[model samples]
Target chain A: MTVRSGAAARSGARGRPGAGGRPGGVARLVVRTVSEVCVTAGTLIVLFVVYVLFWTGVRADSAMDGEIGKLQDQWSTGPVAAGTPGATGGQPSGPGKQPPYENGKSFAVMYIPRFGADWSKPVLEGTAVDVLKKGLGHYGRTARLGETGNFAVAGHRRTYGDPFKDFPRLRPGDAVVLTDGTTWFTYRIDRRPYRTLPTDIGVIDPVPRESGYSGPGRYLTLTTCEPEWGHSHRLIAWAHLDSTQPVERGRPSALTG
Target chain B: MYGWIWRHLPGNAWVKALVSLVLVLAIVYVLFQYVFPWAEPLLPFNDVTVDRGMGAVR
Candidate 1:
């Protein structure tokens, strides 16, 4: 043991000349510094993963619930508060003509029966990162809720509350329902989940190119990451407006049933 | 590295340990509140849009 220790000490000293002339001084310092940096980096990565996987979901879920609660409060009252004009007690004229939705503002609540009975999420106006962290985001360019053109929305498939965690489970003839406080819009899925490149912006077009959609209609485009936890591609689902009912009537059959 | 931090800490053994823990906790809080939230969007997992721009805020 002593001989081996002596040999190691001598070798370490020879590894760095003029390094304090102390045995194993420079080599040990270099190794220690490298290892310490690596350990620190490894720990930071773990912490970041924890933040993305668990912390973001926790905060996002509460944020979504808060948005829903506030929208409900607005509904219980008469007209929606300012910043959301044209939120009337009367019937909607149709898509393409309505008050402009405030950016980062939640204007509706969405539900998919295929996801789960209790599943619900707020639909925000813009598809900003901050907005999506709270709830699903409406593509600014698409049609409004239940509008004639495509009303597209985006959501995280894995993190940020996992609004689209069950997106793949969506199949043809499934129902996607939404209520903008004044009206209940029920949209029926037209096809199964379609996987495409992220660059395929046509998926959210007025009549999505590959959704088997032939012409313009009251379409709904739902987009999320392709893989469960990665973003190498996009998963899309298209739906057509099936029916509409005034909020005063009650929840839509798609929800109650 | 931890030993260096412990040596530099101006306190008794227990106080030093407590300070170290507090420092770590403080760092984690900052990361969670500001750093992680900002850096998260810069990463790819949050990309749900159909646009091709990687980590695009759009």
Candidate 2:
């Protein structure tokens, strides 16, 4: 009877029949638990570290972009702010006259409500590492809204974890919204894909050889690598600026809420 | 991490060591899969930290 009782106690302790005969079970469990914790902590730490590092670059770039926008706004409104007519300070009045670069922390994300989880990643800037990882970057040289040329923004397609993983799936009539809380700009996809090398200037030509554009029309050329995995060709999506409004007012009607 | 667990788990040690390693890995996996997401928002590496300023006052 004593031997049977001992066997039962051992099994109960290990939760496996006859397992209590194993020595130091509790201690082993504790050690295993600690090791598991260490592994998990290490993984989380690595992920967090990478996220933080890139986040700083993202914030800085956003802030700098905001600053540039403020400066441009001041310059643009300076003449009006001073109540002067044609206060053009000998500066050209078109895309060529505008500053080649802008800085501002204010950026609005344009999401295609139509796309589901397929369009989850945020737009980041530049094809470069620092910018592509965070948020989309407006081409430093592209024209601004209400302008007469192809203003462009380029981003990575596959590398750096592919923020634009599904950009290739974009179809005609996708809506893009740019915002700074106070102002929101809506653009509609009017143009389809155009392939070119990064250095191909003709791809960004204000007027394509085939398409005739007249008057001052706002345009957007979103460029990324062609195909999903390779950079042999550049993929360009063209859109015309539809309207500009305050973000507080919500999305434009063309975007269908 | 599974990698870490696989690395640290005993191949040469007795059952005691292997059990110990397994327990540790389970704890870590729990912390990673369940706790890490919540903790992420509070970590020091957060881009949007508590301080609202860009280290400069207006």
Candidate 3:
């Protein structure tokens, strides 16, 4: 009888508690389930908020791009108005010149369709302040757009919500469309990662590491802060210009007049 | 009356704590995910347009 009683007590302890049965156990379960639901809901809410904030930043950036796009369009098609002067050339430098940037800070804006409309930013002339503020900047001596040389463009990777948000996704053979849209230039990704300092002026040199030039095959280099804000290295995406297409105003394919 | 009182009370301390956490989380989730979006546009800078051209030097 004693042994039977001990077994019965042990059975009750194991059955109701260990086996997940009992009114109190049900109550505990209800609490746990509700807690889990709350945590999951909270996590989702935070994620959604983050997504919304990113969307807002994207919109603001797009608005800025729109204004710059207008100016680029005018400069691309509109006449250089016959021999415009330097920084003093009230007339547009007409393409290869230091893009008509304000304050000695000329910039070329590169827009990639696959990267989204807002991916556009001022290409600063040599990673300077004035240029970074406006957009991605072109290396001063790198091959000018349309020229058969290495055209290097650099931008911030993390700050300002990471302008190159989708850059890491670019694959070889991906089409990178750069336009003032009048002079549409396409570059195919070719090179792998190359690390260099802000002052490594030679990295953007026209001659690309002895890659025998096919008569200055138009090349492109994209530089951004590496590993995010830490900037311990520079991420470079290199490509060769595949083709160019001209946009006629009021045309169906042109982004604008 | 006694049974009703017991029903209203949580089964244990852990259950009470869990219920409290759940309630708090639900309130936070509703406020941020649903309510905040509706309220964001009302903020002054929320829609304030930034004129980038303003920084362009003549």
> What is every candidate's C-alpha DockQ against the true complex, given to 2 decimals?
0.70, 0.04, 0.05
- Candidate 2 regions exceeding 4 Å error are A1-106, A117-127, A159-161, A208-216, A254-256, B1-58
DockQ of 1: 0.70
lDDT of 1 by residue, A2-121 (tens): 999999999977765756656567678789989999999999999999998899989999999999999988889766433221233224455435676899999899999999999999
**Candidate structures ordered by TM-score, highest first:** 1, 3, 2
Clashing pairs in 1: none
**Candidate 1: stretches off by over 4 Å:** A1-21, A80-96, B52-58
- Sort order, DockQ high to low: 1, 3, 2
Model 1 lDDT tens row, B1-58: 7777889998799999899899999999999999988898878877899864532544
Task: List TM-scores for all candidates, in order.
Answer: 0.86, 0.48, 0.49
TM-score of 2: 0.48
Q: Tens digit of lDDT per residue, candidate 2, span A136-191?
A: 55554456543556656665554334445566666667776654334556667765
Candidate 3 lDDT by residue in tens digits, A95-139? 455443343343345666557744555444544433443456665
Error (Å) of candidate 1 at residue A222 is 0.4
* CAPRI class of candidate 1: medium
Query: How many angstroms is residue A152 displaced in model 1 relative to the true structure, after the best TM-score fit?
Result: 0.5
Worst ten in a row by lDDT for model 2 chain A: A81-90
